[model samples]
Target: MIGRLNHVAIAVPDLDAACAQYASALGATVGAPQDEPDHGVTVVFIDLPNTKIEFLYPLGDDSPIKGFLEKNPSGGIHHICYEVDDIVAAREKLLAEGARVLGNGEPKIGAHGKPVLFLHPKDFNGCLIELEQV
Candidate 1:
């Protein structure tokens, strides 16, 4: 089962501009940009009191984020991550419930260095959901 809200991920065409807006206009604390080649994204985290906002940009032409940006030129909320106590158990439960898991149905190392899995957007009311083990 899902736990606390981990972070909301937003795909942005321009990573630096997005980070600058959050840091200056919103007066938020933006973390350093990190390249997650495995995930094909360059990300920056905006720290918040309760949760975090993740800014995602395409790392290469083949990056999934690039396709997302192509569909949404202005960029938008890419996914919402929720914490899980045990990813394997959670995956099994969701699978048994008929929910579709994305990408080979296996957990991958996320931006936080935690095991993460992505669920099909249609399965979760048109919003991509990420489950991260905490």
Candidate 2:
């Protein structure tokens, strides 16, 4: 079952600028960079009260975030990540219910070094879904 709302993932054109904006606006302290090569993003986490916020930018031309930014010039919220206790079971349940998986069958290391997977937006009312196991 999904646990807490882990963090909200936001795709930004410039990670540093976004981090600064959140810090100034919400008094959030920016954490160190987290490189998720499997997801093709390098992000910084901003600590928040109930949940954290992630600022994501492509690390290279081939990153998915690069394509996302190209499609969304101004950048936007990429996905809402919900924390799960068992990612394997949650993935199976999602698939069983006909949800499309964004990534391969294997769970990849994600931001904060947790196992994570993304569900396709087409199956989620155009809202990208991220399931993270902590």
Evaluate all candidate structures by whole-model CA lDDT and list the values in order.
0.93, 0.85
After superposing candidate 1 on the true structure, give the runs of residues whose Cα lies further than 4 Å from its correct spot: none
Per-residue alpha-carbon lDDT of candidate 2 for residues 34-126, written as tens digits (9 for 90 to 100): 887766889898888789888888986689889789999889998999999999999999889998887576788776678989899888889
Q: Give the TM-score of candidate 1.
A: 0.95
Could you tell me which residue pairs clash in candidate 1? none
lDDT of candidate 1 over 1-134, digit per residue (tens): 67899999999989989998999999999999999888789999999999999999999768989988999999999999999999999999999999999999989988788999999999999999999999
Local error of candidate 2 at 43, Å? 0.9
Candidate 2 positional error at 96, Å: 1.8
lDDT for predicted candidate 1 compared with the true structure: 0.93
Scored by Cα lDDT, where does model 2 land? 0.85
Report the Cα lDDT for residue 82, model 1.
96
lDDT of 1 at 31: 95
RMSD (Cα, Å) of candidate 1? 1.0
Could you tell me how far off, in angstroms, the CA of residue 81 lies in candidate 2 after the best superposition? 0.8
